[model samples]
Target: MNGDVHVDLKTDSRYAGRLQYSCSNKICTLRITDLRESDSAEYKFRFITNQPGGRFTGSPGVTLSVRGLQVQVRRSSVSYWATLMCYSSCHLPDHSSYVWYKNGQKIQRETFSSYSGNFYYPDSYSCAVKGLEGFPSPSVCGHGHSCNRVTYTDRSICAVKGSSVNISCIYNSYDTDIRSKFWFSPERSLQWQNPSQPEDLSEDSQYAGRVQVLETERGRSTLRITDLRESDSAEYHFKFTAGSFEWRSSLPGTTLTVTDPDLQVQVIRSTDYTYNQAELLCHSSCRLPDHSSYIWFKNGQKIQTETSSSYSDYFDSADSYSCALKGLEGFPSPSVCVYGQTCNRVTYTDRSICAFKGSSVDISCTYNSYYTDIRSKFWFSPERSLQWQNPSQPEDLSEDSQYAGRVQVLETERGRSTLRITDLRESDSAEYHFKFTAGSFEWRSSLPGTTLTVTDPDLQVQVIRSTVYKNYTEAELLCHSSCRLPDRPSYVWFKNGQKMESVETSSYKDQFYPRDIISCALKGHEDFPSPSVCEFNRLFQRRYNTN
Candidate 1:
């Protein structure tokens, strides 16, 4: 079409490398490697015979469509089971047998049509034809959907403010004609039954741009809310409508409790480092459930991994300590310093490092050890550890799936070690510490491991005005990150493109008036501040007047 021959099956430079053709018994077969979507076309094969005028072309050329397989999930008639079908627009051979996989592992051999089994999660399934087993279809999860009902994976969850939480459930509809799916908290007095109300909570200004509804195969819907606040603590429900029939489920719905992190340090003065002497316990103001586990920190460094509510370690009165729930390390308690510990022996160059996503961070620490020959030197972070490991058990954090390719242990000198992480993800935000083994003695540095905060920063604002009490009206603007960051992060606030002085704290309190445009961002990351949240005096007037 562009003054060039397009169909050069034999000599085309691009196709020459992969295209192959064989002619035998008057049948010509053409094969190409790594087919592209643009390869869809019809090609007629002309045959030439030894006899005069024996050349002829096939009347109807074969049409080839190159496309990937997509797996469609259906609820089986049998309860708790799902049927996965792999589909391709190009008609497959009649004799094709299907191969099935569960969580990327082959589960079934040559079988007919589809695969059926008791599906469980966190396992997902996909299917492929016998010959193209290498390129399996996209995975579809066994979403725990019951017959025409909605089921939650967990009935209750706890989240930290400024962190994200996901509320998920599996739903089913026998009608097959799904019109809509949504998540909402009836506590807000917003119900789908109200025709005027938006079907999804994301449409509400309060939750817009902050809530995400993710759907997987077999009707699994997960509502992920970022920058959670105290007001977010509530029971959440899911609803879906099929044709004319609709169902909203609140029975045993997911209840989320959001809390702020508070760390209290208790130190006993003693000379020796032991559980009984000069011991430190990281405490929380509010006790979690008995079954919940605890993580301990010395200064800012993690020191204990006991699952109990409190962590006790041989920390001197001079050392600083903190604590947090095991799974909720993102919301670590504030560090409290004792009279003093020898934190001077080994300390991080920077107490905390905040960098943008995809950026690299270097966490360096200087140390003083009596022993000279360091046998084993390594670096690890709370993000990589599920439980605390004593010096006796040294795990290769480099081998961890999360840090495998992203971490590097660097030692520039005898007394200094640097932990370099690349391509930072939100999960990489954690306190990294250095460990060394010197001839029969093992040491894990404490007090302060370099805390890294990897953020694709976003700002969020919450208006907290108590109409019932009529006490006060104030808007609290906060710089929010997807992950929990240092509670004391300095913030910069702006009003109508003008910087506001003394607005350094994360949450800015202001008596906002109508038509006031305010925004906030992290100290250094002021470029992408929060979208302006304007307050309307009319709404505030109505709210206060009612109460």
Candidate 2:
């Protein structure tokens, strides 16, 4: 149907016997009994209908195309159970029967006289036929530069005691749920044994009480495994049967690795001080905690005994210790350690300085220890030098409108604290400052600010082609942006100059590798398509959010 074609049939005969005629409705029917000698240019059907006046002659042709075993996967490194859809289309009024096969071996599953379908199973999938003729080699969504090639995020890592892990095999097959899908191991038989059990088959074979399909909401699914055990590591396979079509499994193996959440504290530094008289003070730190606490340690251990501090020895007459040992000051320099380990690692790592209007860079900071609890971590770009503007507040120093969306911290968890920034324009770069507070102890920063270069976030746009015969898929434009987020930046996905959103005020964000990489993928499916990521100023304004 993509192009135009002209076809015709002709034959001459004078004296002939009564010719046979066969056709259901107004269509012509051609019958061939021989298989080996049936190699011809076309299959022609002649129709001669007797009318009241005379007889009319009409004929038609059906092209015969023979297909072979051909299956493809978008990514060569995808996990097992990933979807592998097999399909083929042709011009036909009605099909009598349909069948499928693998390596020439007949496949026994669901059959479809209709052409296209999918397989959620893992393995090789292909098709054969009975009444229909001509087939083509199948192709899959393989890996390459195109985004449509199905790049995966390696979310296959599952936790031992966690809930079912979702493995979304997303790709528009434009078919129904019944289509066969391949779910299997590429190297070995993919299987999952209970994480809480032994590796012997004496319990249960293939997946013996271990693997389960993750639930689907809004039509997305993932393969899940619970009670993660060491032996529950293996590839799984899924093969599909759709009419005469079969496709092989191209998904990578799904393995189950056991991981447990654990953390411990180890004191790396401790010192007793007695700068002057009756007060005894000490300082100590450990592997530290991110965004959690600021508890002080005393007498070789956590301050498991005291609560408040009152005084400190002369202490160099420079830096003052909070709530020191008042009465103990005279009893020799008593131990008074103030711990500062609760800085959010994900939000306060790589502390850096931002750039000015004409030239600037992003600030960074991270906290990965297991000490004190983190309070609030923030950044100051060149303090009073660089130009500033916040979308919410005014750009004034003390309470100036300095930063808005650009100032951010990673969503706090039990283990990390860090920050990232993006969309760095010239005025948006410079010495970015870092300030973190854990419990009662506060840590401002290290020396000057972290410098950022706003030359341009590595950005580019491109197009993608599809191997599947033109279906109901849309032409999508891909936008790629690469930048190291020093501060947590609100990635504003923009389509043209306007933003892509359900609400003008609500902001959307997802987390990736903290501190190192952050990406914003907004589908560009409209005309005049141009996608971009914008990180607004935070100090100058208030972050806009629905929450």
Candidate 3:
């Protein structure tokens, strides 16, 4: 060995990762590993020749400095909507990509080059919690541009991998400056998803790539997944960034269920019919109502084109099962048996609640047995007062203006049926009854109707300015209550022997100061037309207007 040579490592394993080296020594080769700075010095070379004084020499050699990349948040002090820039002080070359981790979560990455300057190339980005726009102070964003930013994005829920869902987006910023918005799969894999804007879009695999954001507003996005698989159940997150701002977002996903139409036949929506011309109705309700199909079959024969809204929408009509609804999938099964209240084997479910014009409530029903083979189910409210379903006393599903389409059946089948009602007014309050039929047996229960007592919230009423007109201009009567019940209570104002219609709503907040519950006010009640003193009550309790 006569020459002295030097090998300078651009980076050691630590500054980067790990290092490996091998040397061929004479009759055999030598291998060494796990090398670190501790072994940063001398090496000797030897040659095994037949000569005893064979060649042997020592050389003072190269220094290998491992420059590994370590990232850190500049400042620990942080607030909502703040931006924290990342500072990387490393003299490294354009090798592999750089990955950024936030709160231990790996964000997008960045690509560095020999010619790229740290100042021109941003490794620091801004972050806002959720979708709120505003700078969160003292924040840290990893720099390594693996993916671009997502801006002005919206999210919605739907069956997984079913169909790509459209999420609306908006961007008032520059278009060319922003490159793209990246879609992360349930597994957090980065993939360019379909941008569903300015046209029709489809769901993708894992989202089927069916998701798309507007090209102009790439940050605004919509997700579409097709052939929804159960494994597709998970949360999907998206991160969008443009020249100056970056947005990080995520959505909690939902599950997918491919359901079959629970078909069957029966008539029981209206009044008690021992045997009369009562209307027979059928009903079908499911989470994804569109997936369920309806067919009218009699004695193993499918009936086509003869079902009415009444015949197929209800189960126990005191009437005839003469009509059927066809091509209507997602609806409960069809019914052929004429409805009646015959055998005392009576069975049913009833639940109810009360609320003011601005509150919410839920109702439910159930049968005696909770079987599985039983396919179809139905629900009806006596308030519906269906006419044809029950001639003598029909609880019409179509005739009741108050009930409308507000009722839905919660399918916990083989057992109870539930319904959710929202934004209830006083008029929405009532003793809602349930009539469900599974298998060949029909059940009706109404003894203890589900009672919902939605007491009115305090009402607030007052003319914008004043109610003192020159000759008493029709004073506006405002009726307001924070009552949790939807059924609104009718108000009767009496001044003398005269009657006045007390109209208007919402008076005041429920809890005021310390103990003041609420207040309601109504106008137009005069002492002459009927009675100036108006009586407002729910469940028969007069609520004196105090606002």
Better candidate number, 1 or 2, judged by lDDT: 1
lDDT of 3 by residue, 1-547 (tens): 1156222221121211122234555333333333333544454443333343444444653334532223333332333222233332335333443333332233444322111222212333332222221211122233333333233232223332232333334332222476445444444221222111111223334433534444443334544444445555444554444666554433222222333322334332223233243333333221222332334443223456544443333333322122223443322242244433332222223323445444445565544333334443454445545434565343533245565666545666645556666656665555655554456644443233455554434443332211222222223344433343234444433233333344233322121121112223333221112112222221012111123
Best model per lDDT = 1
Error of 1 at 338 (Å): 9.0
Candidate numbers, best TM-score first, in rank order: 1, 3, 2
> CA lDDT of 333 in candidate 1?
55
Rank all candidate structures by their lDDT, best first, as comma-separated numbers: 1, 3, 2
What is the alpha-carbon lDDT of model 3 when measured against the actual structure?
0.36
**lDDT of candidate 3 at residue 242, scale 0 to 100:** 68
Per-residue lDDT tens digits of candidate 2, residues 516-544? 12123323213322233221211011122
Q: TM-score: which candidate is best? A: 1
State the C-alpha lDDT per candidate.
Answer: 0.64, 0.34, 0.36
What lDDT does candidate 3 reach at residue 1?
17
